[model samples]
Target: MGTEGGHGHAIDTSIPSAARMYDWLLGGELNFEADRKACEDLLEIAPSSRELALNNRWFLERVVRFLARERGITQFVDHGSGLPTRPNVHQVAQEVHQGARVAYIDIDPIVIAHGRTSLEVNSGTRFIEASMTDTGRIVEQASKGGFIDFGRPVAALYVSVIHCLKDREEPAAMIRRMREHLAPGSYLVICQLVSDEERVRREVTELMDQGTDGHWGRVREKHDVRRYFDGLSVLAPYLGDVTHWRPDSDLRRPQKSLEWVEFGGVARIR
Candidate 1:
């Protein structure tokens, strides 16, 4: 468990945080009453939210295991990595290759606090506090002490966090910047909240924005997420509900709801 972060901000229990809300949805106890209430409101808008979160989490694990075990990807950079959970990226990757390295990046105060406390024993992993879109600093810090080798292949994972960016924040541009830092054999694992129903998208986006005080981005359509992977070589089962993204054979996942989904897939940087 090794950890370091750029920020030392104290956790504010009065306001809602996307990371904490997500923790609450995952049945984790690192959240405050505010986050729990916010999740309750979110459930009203999208009844399948808990199911959606679980599926997205499952997708993350499935992809990480597949990349480390099957593709021989030994290093992983997890952007916007929320509160620590079971079978984290480092855990999954290390299972395949004991020396595998992982860097967890997130700007949330609570995430940084809990991460530093809980992940202090793993020497091969790091928890960095910074905006995932902060390409320059993230690239710099993740590279320190040979934490991650830019010369070697790596997996840059956005997972379900890109939706936290506003349009002006240019999530795609951030991806492009990170892609520029990876080797030809490296890969990008991305996914975000998307919906086919316009109403579902509008309402959820609005509610989250208000709940987090504009710390959230809009829910987009499938095509919107597709554009993020413009030049990357997408793996099979390209861009759809994450629930169906190469599901595990031994494990049964929850079914996807019609209103919205966490959508995206794995893509090679080349």
Candidate 2:
């Protein structure tokens, strides 16, 4: 197993991490007690959190398969890739094309540790510990590591993670930076928590911000997320609820959460 943490920071169980909380939501055992408790509190605010997480994960897999099988993309960069889960980006892409290469990027130490162990034997995959905003460094490292070729069409996936960025982070600008780095015809997969109800957006955002110690971003409206794909060619159905984005028959039963939903879609860089 290969595991490397950029800062070598020890895991702190005192603070709740979004990644660990997400793990808890997915019924994964890689989370700490703090994460579990935090998720419990989160569930109180957004009762459908677990359903949202599962649907978003399925959307990620579907898009990756589409890019690999339909678009013939051979390389992928999964930004903010959380703790290793079944049917990871590489696993989904490789199923379509065995030679496909994937680079998983995340700032969570636990994710890096667990990712390295899970991907160690896979020569075509790599786990990088870094902020997704560090597009240049991530692209450079993935290129230098020889797992991802920037010259070819690459799928840059922000899937369900952009909500971790604060307003000052300029998430849209971050997407633009990545788009500038990718080759033409490359794809960008994005989805984040959104709500039409002002109360749901405000309350959920506040709850997550406090629980994660301000490491959370506000739940945005549909229009705000739309700006992230400006000038790019969005895939069919445009931007809407992720649950309906090319759903498979095996998809879990939809959760009745009119409060909020995971929304966004894949777009091709022109």
Candidate 3:
């Protein structure tokens, strides 16, 4: 178990990982029985877990397209990017502009394995095995490899993964650091599990914390997430449930779950 071809690492199937559980929710097979059981328990809490995952994924695709086509952003850094789902960042961006380059970062060994294999043939893309907070290493590796140019207007994405970060980890501060690293006119795409219900927040946070062996962050309120976008120019309609943020034709029907939602938006770094 080591980093080889950027895919080698010890995978402990005994515990469920947030990335693997997320893959299971999305109907992917990159998960183990532990992950499946965790999802089952998660569904009992958030009955619409699967739907929420799908909506969040759709939001990701739409935002990437907007960045590539309308915003003319050619580079992307997908922080905490999980298992390779269909229409990945590079696929969405490159579809708009074939020259688009993307660097996917994640700490999950399974994600690294799948991402490296799926992206092996794509010269314009690369995967880095590292925590999302290791911004310096990520930028250095991405720039040195020519997979991303820090000098250009790159989009740094933290979609649906911030909930995995504890407060002490300072997710907001991490975003600020990344904001400083990016060039002017760069963008930040963020969203995470947010709930208005205190019960839902507490229970889900506790459940995930236990399920992932304390590798989980607390579920936060919308205002807590809002602080992450403070001082930045939020895109049209402002920060809200991602399902309502620039939805394409395919997302005409909104998700009806009120227990929680992926809350946040895209912001431009001035």
Candidate 4:
């Protein structure tokens, strides 16, 4: 973490970060030139990269809205939260349930820096900086925050973040730990970048790894993502491309490649 001097926080421009790259993909100005260049290179290989980002964001909004409005779930925990983008989880949930409380968690210093500035003031929102691997610590901190009551059904979101984990960390195990903490009838929303085309996966993974100085994770196979939902009961539509999973019509669009897209689904703890 390289400091910009005032916020006592470091903004490292030397290594490209996924959050920054995502900001670039979404046309935000919070990223460095390295992030932009990496996004461009990724686009050259995966032309639909930007669209994929938008689609995934849409999925997040829809899931939050559903939990708040339809299911009467007022507590949300967003893990691996990226930069503070428009219509974030808190915004969407609060619209449906004004008293909805949300806790945003992320390991990146940039996320924490921006979160403190943007989210800390909201009465029902708070941001905590921590790695996804520290599920116990995350749960403990969130429990102390008073916004999220683990004793009740809480929505735990892992949207578009699991791919950041390597096999050694056992992303599935992390999910299981969170599940063990949630009350029955809770919800789990997950999605990860996936592709059936090996060449597409290899090229995108290699290019991103190089450009970001190995900060990115491998693009997984579709089935591998589905397996993450093993213990939970999947919602009616089961898992598929992120764009196709109960997507809003306005956000629905055709795919540019037959290779793959972000894939996963929502499930309930039965």
lDDT of every model, 2 decimals:
0.84, 0.82, 0.85, 0.80
Report the lDDT tens digits of candidate 1 across residue range 1-270: 001121247666877888888888888898899889988988888888888888788888999999998899999999988889998889989999999999999887878878888875799888887888888998899899888999999999998888888899988899889999999889999888888888889998898888777778888888889998998899999878878988888666585456788888999877
Clashes within 3 Å, all models in order:
4, 0, 0, 2
TM-score of 2: 0.94
In the range 12-57, model 3's lDDT, one tens digit per residue, is 8888888888888888888899989988998898887888888888
Off by over 4 Å in 1: 1-8
Question: Which lDDT tens digits does candidate 4 get at residues 1-270?
Answer: 111111124667867788888887777888898778878888887888888887788878888988788899999999888888899888999898889888888877787888889888898887877777788888888889566899999999998888777677788898999999999989999888888889888998787667656556678898788788997899968888767776666746666665658888999987
- In angstroms, give how far residue 153 of model 2 lies from its true place: 0.5
Per-residue CA lDDT of model 2 for 141-227, tens digit only, reads 999956677777889988888888888989999999998889988999988888898988888878778866677888899999999
Q: After superposition, which runs of candidate 4 have C-alpha atoms over 4 Å from their true positions?
A: 1-10, 249-253
Candidate 1: the clashing residue pairs are 1-119, 1-120, 1-121, 1-122
In model 2, which residue pairs have backbone atoms overlapping below 3 Å? none
Worst 10-residue lDDT window, candidate 2:
1-10
Distance from true location, Cα of 43 in model 2, Å: 1.2
